[model samples]
Target: MKEERELQDVLVQLSSLAPGPADAPKPAGQALAVIKRQVKQEKRAGCQPWQRFWQNPNRRWATAVLSLLILFTVAFSFPAVRAAASDFLGLFRVQKFAAISVSSEQLALLERVAEEGVSPGELTIVNAPGALIPVNSLAAAARETGLEQVLSPAALGEPDEIDVVEGGDGRLIIDAAGARRIIELAGADPTLFPEKLDGKRVEVVIFSGVQQSWDDGTVLLQTTMPLVEYPGNLDPVPLGEAMLQMLGMNRNEAARLARTIDWTSTLLLPIPRNVATFNEITINGSSGLALASLDGQYGAVMWQQNDVLYLLTGSGDTVELQRIANSVR
Candidate 1:
């Protein structure tokens, strides 16, 4: 059987170089010589001392180990892989949320704003700030990732209050309920500002947040926008990327990825979903990820950098949010 297998192998090779079967009538002597010569060449091809190295048991292991090393080297050397790894490494560096407070008058204004009517349900701050202090604390993550503008410890106020009193964290805090009520009364939805949401519901809440205190008796305001507030028809990654770019990350990938997002998905934000997801697509040959807020109503996307994360938020005020996202350093 072994001999038969060898003969077949030899036959296949010989047939490749020989004349067609029609010429099989050639003299037996020449045919025998050709067969013998073919066998000799096949044998010689495998006879080299160097060729025999492949047959060594240790060499086979060495080759496998060497190949693995090369693959690993290449994998770690890739820019995409390297960036992802770096991001993972730096992710733990994010700071936790800090609680904040405002002056007594601002506290009074906040209470009045709530009286003016935005629902607490609309106010999405995770932690509740005390009544007298005024303002809330927020996850450092939001500010770090560029969602700062969409979120606030203070509510939106009238034009003069635009910079009414800058919080320790450098954000404009106002009695948003009052301002929003006034604006909406004029037919505007705070979410899609300038163009009112057209829904005739009363919003009556002043969102309080975690508070962070600075050395000068000043406190950084804590804040978060409720998922119900604005429809973030955007993926978190793209949102983040937009936020980052707006905040001064002028790299090509940040710019390219930020542009790929359609503002439509941002409308989905207010709709709730349990398992929101974010997908990162390659932009200009660089890596990016979209955060689908995993909720049905909205999603936002963001991109990862060695030491930063960015997100998108707010629809009508998207330009404003973009301005805010860009406001980050």
Candidate 2:
């Protein structure tokens, strides 16, 4: 029964990652019922013990790898935001990483908002970053990205495939009214939004990057310095706080965490606490954030060096992950 419940939970987590239309009926529960019925049938048919199959470390590791791969692939595809005005005060860069504990329920709520919520309004996509281009070798990828140095994992040898994403520029116009509506939908106070932030125009500049993948499912991404610009007089703290609240944090907790963030120089990575364990670590003399599934089967490490951002994810414990990270040159 315990093993069956665990399998059901894993299925639920996988289902949640896949976003469907807001009005689409949820089939996860129904699917779980069907899976349960099948399990019972197998038992009556005198099939192999389910517990033994569930307890296989290799199988667990594969599951973890698949989950993390999907999670990070979606995340890294998000285009970096920027502002075009000469007077924009803030220049945001990926200087360091901070991992915050986020529950799976909170993640589900955020996904729901994304699927059903209103847009920021008056948004425009200018020079959208081009799709990933397949490359024949690491040297070709580096050439396409214009990176002086392209790092690879010495521990894992050569990658089976390589791809590059060309950088470009764009703009975003935020409608205060629409933004406030999203806050209210999250059960947060709309008044927390800054009045000056209304109708603000944010410029986006995308950076060229390369992705390398190994046959065993390990992935490495490296990108040049990406930046974001904001008006000098604007205070982003309040907006950050409100966003934290929308992510299911209490007002006070959200405020505290928001204030601690560098807003301009740091990249925040929210790790679902129920699914993974996260901590700070050093990779090849650079500070990095490391995350591993609670089962210790899969993990990832992200860090920045010489203005280049690097992310590595694969199946292994944190120690093995760090070893691979350190092997990158």
Among the numbered candidates, top TM-score falls to 2
- lDDT (C-alpha, whole model) for all candidates: 0.30, 0.66
Runs of candidate 2 exceeding 4 Å displacement: 1-91, 127-130
Scored against the true structure, residue 143 in model 1 reaches a CA lDDT of 45
In the range 88-157, model 1's lDDT, one tens digit per residue, is 1111122111111223443243334434544212222233222223232233323432333423212222
The digit string of per-residue lDDT tens for model 2 on 221-250 reads: 788756565556877677667766765789
- The TM-score obtained by model 1 is 0.17
For residue 10, give model 1's deviation from the true position in Å: 99
Per-model TM-score versus the true fold: 0.17, 0.70
Q: Could you tell me which 10 consecutive residues in candidate 1 have the lowest summed lDDT?
A: 162-171
